[model samples]
Target: MGLGLFRMFNCFSSKPREIPIILGSETPPRPKQRQRKEELGGGGESKIGGILGRPYVDINTMYEMKKELGRGQSGVTYLCIERSTGREYACKTIARGKLVRKEEIEDVRREIMILQHLSGQPNIVEFRGAYEDRQNVHVVMELCSGGELFDRIIDKGTYSEREAARLMRQIVTVVHVCHFMGVIHRDLKPENFLLASKGSLAPLKATDFGVSVFIEQESQSHMNPIHRRRRQTEANKACQHTVQQNQRRPRRKALTDINELYRLERELGRGQFGVTYLCTEKATGRQYACKSIARRKVTRKNEMDDVKREIMILQHLTGQPNIVEFKGAYEDRQHVHLVMELCRGGELFDRIIARGSYSEREAASICRQIVNVVHVCHFMGVMHRDLKPENFLLVSRDHNAPLKATDFGLSVFIEEDKVYKEIVGSAYYVAPEVLKRNYGKEIDVWSAGVILYILLSGVPPFWGETEKQIFDAILEGKLDLESAPWPSISAAAKDLIRKMLAYEPKKRITASAALEHPWMKEGGEASDKPIDNAVLSRMKQFRAMNKMKKLALKVIAQNLSEEEIKGLKQMFNNMDTDRSGTITFEELKSGLSRLGSKLSETEIRQLMDAADVDKNGTIDYYEFITATMHRHKLEKEENLYKAFQYFDKDSSGYITRDELRHALTEYQMGDEATIDEVIDDVDTDKDGKINYEEFVAMMRKGTLDNEGVIGKERTR
Candidate 1:
């Protein structure tokens, strides 16, 4: 009977006099919506909703307006029945177009943004989505069929202390989580709360965010200082633009043929859906990576669906600091082009390897950044699903640079308490619950725990000679804090790892909660110490494993579930070329070379020998995957250095104005004044040239692409 039930009263002493009220009080009839200002071409209403200039529709396609739910000054709410689900939802229709005030339009936009921001919260009314057309905007949300808190209260007349107390607690808890997420519910009343279903045990949800606001306030309390600083900066910026503000958005050009707009320098890497390349924009001569996806090659409907899903996800996640910025996407006859931020510093694995010996402090630093990204994703109800060293990218080569999470192909939107049955993600990093086919977003936490274990001990807690054995170890989730590394590592680090790697999903530490763990605290005293030889030796064991054994593990892991092997099958088929269900050495070599891997004869032979598991001349699909899947992150790091070398024409360890001009000449950036301007923006030490670190920061796209901030990194 806690506050989650949304009860109205606590005790007889504190109970208020109930004002008699009917549940569905209809309002006095008003005139119909001022003549339909503009009707879409397809008839009375749009078929679907569209944002900006996208295609839109009227509610009729999927929903039938049954009756009026409620009304406000500028909008009316109706009970809408979805055609497919046959479920009732509250649809709010706001009159827009020429008759609406600009402020009202912005207010509606803000409310929609807030709903989208916290979409899947259990105690918040679910925002299905919004649709817009020429005349009115339609917002679809979960209909609380159980009706209002006030209606229930007035009907019951009064309630006992237990009932009222339980209701109050639920409302307060909802508000607490909202405030924690930066939203301030300006208007809080019993009328705003509703029951999820008809019953005393049902949960209470707070709806109507039209008056709620996201407040930008600086933090002075206990939290991650780094995050606090970011919030403080946001507050300061908000203050600067307290009144009217206008900003021009960048112009994005559409191109059907990618070759006409950009020059492919080299293949970056390939994923299940597409191969990415390092390319230069023909007009600007600026380096960017374009992912080329073959339309015909895509087999499954989900893979095809993922293309649009990934694009939409990237577009929404663009402006976040720890999310790879989306440049834009273009499509032609055969392929789709996804232009994105080119992170030259490479993956987190490469950064760790480059350091050779890493500090616990440094690992914590990277973990903190990763945790920040996880928090952001969770706030938006997004689950990355895959969290591994390879998925995280260092923003720059600088010591204090941030980490960004990329690759949303495997990511999905999840609501609270819902479990996903699909067993996907890399075997080494997957949670035990994932294998069980019953898991929620906490699966991401277990994956992160594996990553943290590798970071601190340089080896995973769950691993074996075979995939089944590895699965056994992960299921056991047994931690050996007394092992070679634990004797040298701190108790705090061991404790946090244990908590995160907890066998039970409920006990596992959440990404948000983990940020406050002792190990992540300022002087919470984990090791600031050096590399322990025992840990290093164990790490070496991982690297020193025979190629054949690793290949065996990869092959077995890929076949765990049917879904896991779908992408591999497609890739294998594509590589087979002759549709023979197997690939020969020549096919392998050609494919590898096109992907930008320079292999000598000796190396190529060694690779062919490793994956020819049956001692056969040609490799089958499973063997092919096992061979190609064993890619090292170091290759990506090598590409980053090649990019730096391209900009450092003289190999002088720094880039000069001439080098910059030469690199960016196509965009009319070769002018002496423009070259100087670019250099001055990134020249941190008041130096006339840009070093590798400064160059990296300058190259980071999106919010951090600000010239003034890059110049101030070390100068101030």
Candidate 2:
């Protein structure tokens, strides 16, 4: 019976490994080549056969080089094509210099290995192959015809919440995959992300893994010792001097320790502990804000340990949207620098100071984001003990873009059962337990509560004249909800703040639990609206049709006679197949197909949805025309949105005058015109109101008649 069972198992396994049997001759016959006359069927011997085993090309053969695409610290990148295959590739060749250290060389090789392992992933740069010469090592990679995402953000000013969120999701997914494979991309920033050529809003790839590291699970412990010793030595030297002292000292001859001062640019900001500067990555000219902390001043061993721990924590907390990305940490003799994504909008503190104060709803929106970020951090076993308005940075004006929580200098990692007794965080936001030197992750929750309170009330819940008084007020835990200034504060919000600011750390609500509170979950009731997916999809399709319409309009504008151009508007009006003031998907798709350039249904939908601000079922003539023109303009080059946004100057859902005047002074019909003329000429409505559609129509007509009115094209 046992023999039979074993035989059954073997039979089941054998079926899985089955291969097709080949039944053929025992020995395969080899074909013999004929003489040149027979081979060429021309009665002449060929030399090709004689050269079969010889080298076909010289090793140092030079090909025609094109424009230099970009450059980096160690190498230069060029747009090149293979002579034999005519395939385009990005050739990155390292320069011979001491700056290209042995470790960095190893890093490049490791990057190659990582790229090779992740070659087929959709959001990673595909590595072709590598070549080494006497002086330089050349790495050939996929040429991303689409430009960098950093450029797009700069040109457009900033991304909308939805766009930023979507992009973050893609980035996090890539990071997730990398971490799962034990490969850490030590350098991850906006400059390293590249868009695909096929779609404007397609997923971006995480590139430039030159500083990446891969460690086995078991060997990770062994590697920490070497890193720690290096950190100690660097810390010792940094402590022995100040920035001025270090600057005056003799520079190291070693390229790695030379401190590439040429790369540094203007100082962005400085704090008590560190300074940040806006610097260009030498190779790509991509700008980055490098935040440098002087290790000399951070003399305490525990504090140094905290900094190192923060780096490790950031590496593990890759997918959280609200946290500012931590690109690798670098330690030199003078400073220990932590490079982060440069949020150009600056801090929430600046915005608050500029605006005076945010509305209750706006504050609530920010509070929700704060809660989400803190919750994500706590869930990952890390606590951001310092939660203040200064630490929250606005990435964009769109209320939805995740507010980046920065400054993890005081962060701590704790297990579920572990309790921390270190007193940390700002005095104003510190928890009552923290004053007693008995704190845990709940201290972070309390600090977050303080931020939420300030956001809503524009003041701290507990205020006093001094630090002692503040601690006393915190201990009392009396929530003054009935005060004159707190009239507008909702009961739910007050309840949340009270729970989060509980005197006992154990009684305080956890970040995750606080996120589910009624105040946050149900706060969107005021802005709630049903989403019509079908209508939205149709509108998106209409936007896709804009490309064809735009080209047609441009051709008519440039080539047609005045009389013909004048008649073109009527023709365009008639071309609106749906008669809903806009062209429909079917009409546009059918029309384009006749020109032998048909857009797929998916493409049409994506374009339409991307352009449609309103979830309306149809697009009007002006909307259709503008969308088409914008699509075509973006197709050819960058900064499409910079010009496109001007068309919507009124900040209304559509474009109108008034809207055009807000965008362009030339379109200002004249302040002397009566309201009636404004209604008649610019407003489609007979009710004397000039809507966006009417304004856009008038502006389009005016622009058609004028030339060189708009300023020179600015490349952002």
Candidate 3:
């Protein structure tokens, strides 16, 4: 009844076709598939229909297969012409050998059933029956030769908002029909929808029911009581929602601008999608971290969905221990501001590095907290797709501050029996199954295991010079348990790590089980002995190496020409809001906040201290320029050479201890230990001095050692 369903679905024509003249006439018995093949001089029948439970039907007799259309994980789609009607159609031939598991076979059967059930619906691909033969199952359906929706969109370069709305209406109609028919189309992406024809107004047809399932009451009853209620609630909410895509320029409810409620402060951190800020509530004066995602940045459908999902996840997981508290979400015209708990203690590794060295017991305690987060997340029916040290923050500056999982950008609700195919998360922490493109909630455990490995050994078990190399190492699975720190690590801790890092996702330890492990449990077997000092030294090599690089960047910033520092002058002026020609601590903080930083007060103070070269407690124009210059400027060979020359003041081609001391002292980081550590880390030849090549290498190394080489998120 919606959108004149009979007109929208061309296959549902009211005009009846003339009855076949031969319908009541005597008919010959259908020949067996094998006999037909023999009479046709074809090969013997193969036993591909063992699971289909029906005799094989020779599809070639009815349709002539032509050129291959495309291929999927387990099947190849081909263009075909029906012999009787001489009409074109698509034939998806799935090989029996590819459906190795019983579940896989069942998936094929379920998809056929779903297509059949949805055949007559608007925006759904028409079903032409499934035929199983000797080698494969052939599903013939309507041929959408207009190609994928994504391809068409790409060809069009950009679509008007009206066009996007029209397309979305078709998609939403499909979803609406699916839910009404008691079906769940789990894998809905741009590629899964195809245009019916090449015309501009061609209807879109949904395909790829490989991961779809029927919403059966029996299945809902099988879920755990807690999960059952949550799933039911979510399902009901999804079905009740209606898409108002056709309402052009619809009125929007007034939203409170985040600035009206909260006084935005200094920047905390910046990410791919948006910038985070330190915000204080006006009435209560209570500070919180606000992640303001620009609406423009989230232009894609998936990106907008991710932002909404993250907000929903944060709200759902709020009040859980070890999870960051969600204060509220405020959406304005420009941005969606998510106000969350202000974690002042900073990143997990930052705290650990500050402690210098920690005992095995301490490592166990930290690991326990991380695993507990996993436990809580899984129990709440959430899968935190991205889990790493940076995503974890301490709630306070206390020595034993509780760790809170702060980011849920890539997280999703745990869909029971669904195998996640999206490759996501940080490269170093990604699970083996994730790389294989089939994984579940167990990936969280693998990531936690990687963190524990770093906690114990001071380096990732999968070490490499590049992201690809790191992925190769992860796949290679060569864990170095006999190495330096590992040799000294307690047996019980190693045992726990082994279980958690098991190559098989099924074999890998569950978060609940890991929490119960002797090494992780309270009053457990973790020893109090301090981990090897080499481990701490290794940690510093990666964690604190950025200090020397920062000083070099400061030098480079000084030498930049007017053109090179073009916008910086204006930026500094903006930051010096008071027109004092110098930016005070508060002004700097507020300016960074406006620019979308969520840096804590202490971190902001540290930045101010670093940039205030003369220790005047404020940043002048030039000082602000130095601190704000981006690292990408160092990509220029000339800029690097000039920075190197600044440190090698004597023109000796080598930065000796005296020269290093001078530069570090100028930057207020001239401690003897720091100087030695810098040389030890950067001087590749074990020489006491840094050469031109060595300096370039040190400056080129990624700030977080092996981190960020794969960017903020690695997705496939």
lDDT (Cα, 0-100) at 553 in candidate 2:
39
Cα lDDT listed for each candidate: 0.58, 0.50, 0.69
lDDT of 3 by residue, 326-349 (tens): 766666878878887999998787
Stronger candidate by TM-score (2 vs 3): 3
Q: Give lDDT: candidate 2, residue 469.
A: 54
For 1-716, candidate 1 gives per-residue lDDT tens digits of 11110111111011111111100100001111232222221224212222221224445765789899898877789999877458789999887753254344445655665675454444788776565666778888888888888787787787899998888888987787576555666667788899887786677888888755555454333434224323333222221211122121111112246676578789776533457899997645878878887776454344444565566556545545588866666667677778777887776865565466777877777777777667656544456777777678777788766787777766664432344665556657778887666777777778788788877776777766434456677778777778776677777888888888888988877777888888876566656777664554444334322321232233343443454344656666666889888777667667656655565432343355445544344677766655544232112344335556766889999978777777655322233443554565567786898887765554332111001110001000
TM-score of each: 0.47, 0.41, 0.51
Give the C-alpha lDDT of model 1: 0.58
Which regions of candidate 3 are displaced past 4 Å? Answer: 1-239, 242-253, 544-643, 646-680, 683-705, 709-716
The 10 consecutive residues of candidate 2 with the worst lDDT sum are: 707-716
User: What is the TM-score of candidate 2?
Assistant: 0.41
TM-score of 1: 0.47
